[model samples]
Target: MIIQKVSDAVSIKRSVESGTEEQRSVVKAIIDDVRTRGDEAVKEYTEKFDRTSLSSYLVSAEEVEEAYERVDAELVDIIREAAANIQSFHEKQLHNSWMTTEKNGTILGQKITPLDSVGVYVPGGLAAYPSSVLMNVLPAKVAGVERIVMVSPPGQNGKLPAAVLVAAKEAGVKEIYKVGGAQAIAALAYGTDTIKPVDKIVGPGNIYVALAKREVFGDVDIDMIAGPSEIAILADSTARANEVAADLLSQAEHDERACSVLVTTSETLAEEVASEVLRQLEELPRKEIASKSIQDFGAIYVANSMDEAINTINQLAPEHLEIIVENAMGYIGQIKHAGAIFIGRFSPEPVGDYFAGPNHVLPTNGTARFSSPLNVEDFQKKSSLIVYSEQALRENKDKIAAFARLEGLEAHARAVEERFKS
Candidate 1:
């Protein structure tokens, strides 16, 4: 990892803008093909990319039942435990439609309605993540989504992973599909003859999936435009170098493009953490991926003061921010933007990724400044409710008509006027 002083803003921008031209063109072509060809296109891509031919996209109930038996009993129990925690956390976010009426018969309030149907895309290949199944589906279920459709790429042998099936069953998914990648996203967004269209789609995938989701945003609501996973650790003199290095590597191992950064006031701590990262990298199974991630995207920014370190973190808007300083709580208010904040030495990013109740599907790149983690609210919509009595309309009609006419909307003025004519 490169160590740099926190004074060069131009270098920071260049370092972070890692997007490529090829990614854009590939995603555009896939999206267009899926939009035009629908189910046939999805199947072709599935066969070509995943190397699996499917007569049907939907995973059968028997497959799910068999998956339950194939998975170890102990692991199934653990999935159940994790599912319970996820369900409990999201239940707290449940909201009811409400209205307030006055004596004058004016009713005004907001109505919260769950989406009719939702689709979740789970990546396959080496990036099969069952934890994503729990994070995406449980919230939709809690929000009372009528139908929950899941899509994942099949392995070379043409079967869904047992763990993925088990998690889907535990989270109460309505259906599961074997199709994956941008084609799967298209099948969910535009709806083929086989797959029903969904109101919203959520979950994470590779660049193709991300770009497909971005392209399909207007057709169906999506969770967010997620980028590669990233972590930024804010450590101080009190933080253990080994612990900080391990946490950084946890996200780094995700992909070659994933970013792992450390910001600290202590130069000694930074040097020690860098050395520890090198030592640990040699033992990791995905060391090649982690090494490239650290060598290219990773950095240790040496700030002159703790306040400067906090400011630098805000600017980066990392997906995960760990404050391993002496008084982690004291610096909580200083953090303005982060998908999730882990405080103190013991809290690592992986805890939230797997066992923690909070959703792990977080905003990546620099999107944490505006986007948020996936939750029940993402599966719900709010509609404004307004009921005006004849008398209420009579009282406000002139004002409403005048405002509309001022805006050059004569039809709006006439509509308001006609309401009170009788």
Candidate 2:
């Protein structure tokens, strides 16, 4: 890892990767075909990309049972516990429809309603991501979304990952489909013979999946167009070099484009962590990926002061910010623009990624400056409520009409005015 001054933090430039024109053309064609041909197009694309052909895309109960048999009992127990944690955490985010009436007999408030249905797309057919299942589904379930559908590509043997199946089942998803890629997103957005269209779609996928989501955005809602994983640690002299190095590599191992940075006031700590990162890279299973990430996007910045270091972190607006300083909590108020904030050495990035209660699906590529982690609100919609009494309408008709006329909406003005006509 190379070191630089905090002010000159140029190596870790963040940019969202839009697919090539060829990839976009392919994704658009797949979406259009699926919209027109429905299940037939989905099946063709699934066979082409996933190497699996399915008579019906829906996963059978027998297949789910088989998945449980493949996974260890202890691991199932763990998945259940994690789901419970996720559910409990998101339950706090739930809000009820509320209305307030004033003395003037006017009712004004907001009605909170959960989406009728949601589709969650889990990536990779051969590998399992039980955590992704729990993270994507549990919040929607907690928000009272009745129909939660899951879609993942199946492997060559026409079987989805056993652990992914177990996780979906554990997360209270009654509907699971073995279809993926741009076709799966299109099916979710536009409905098919076997699969029903959902109000919104959430979860991460490959470039084709991302582009399909981008294409179908107007017809249905989607989660963020997630960039590569990122972690920026704001550490001081008290932070451990090996632990800091390990946390940085945790994100780096995710993808070659994944970014890992450490901003520290201590130059010595910066040097030690850079060396430790290289030493630890050799032992990781995804050594090549991590090494390249560390080489290309990773950085160790030496800040002159704690304030400067904190400012650097805020400027980066990292997806995951770990304050590994001695008093991490005290500086949290000053540090803003992070998708998720992890305090102290004990609270690493993976803690929230896996077993921790918070949603790991977060804004990436400096989008944290505006966006937030996935939560219950994303699964619900709010409609403004207004019940104006006859007297109230008579009193506010002039103001309302004037406001509408100000916007050059004469029809809107007339509609409100006619409601109050003698």
lDDT (C-alpha, whole model) for all candidates: 0.88, 0.91
Encode model 2's per-residue lDDT on 87-112: one tens digit a residue: 99999998888999988899999999
Once fitted onto the true fold, the runs of candidate 1 whose alpha carbons sit more than 4 angstroms away are 8-26
> What TM-score would every model get versus the actual structure?
0.95, 0.97
Model 2, residue 300: C-alpha shift (Å)? 0.9
Against the hidden true structure, what lDDT does model 2 obtain? 0.91
Worst 10 residues of 2 by lDDT: 8-17
Best by TM-score: 2
Across residues 151-266, which tens digit of lDDT does each residue of candidate 1 receive? 99999888999999999999888689999888888889988889989989898887788888888899999998777789999998999988999999998898888889999999
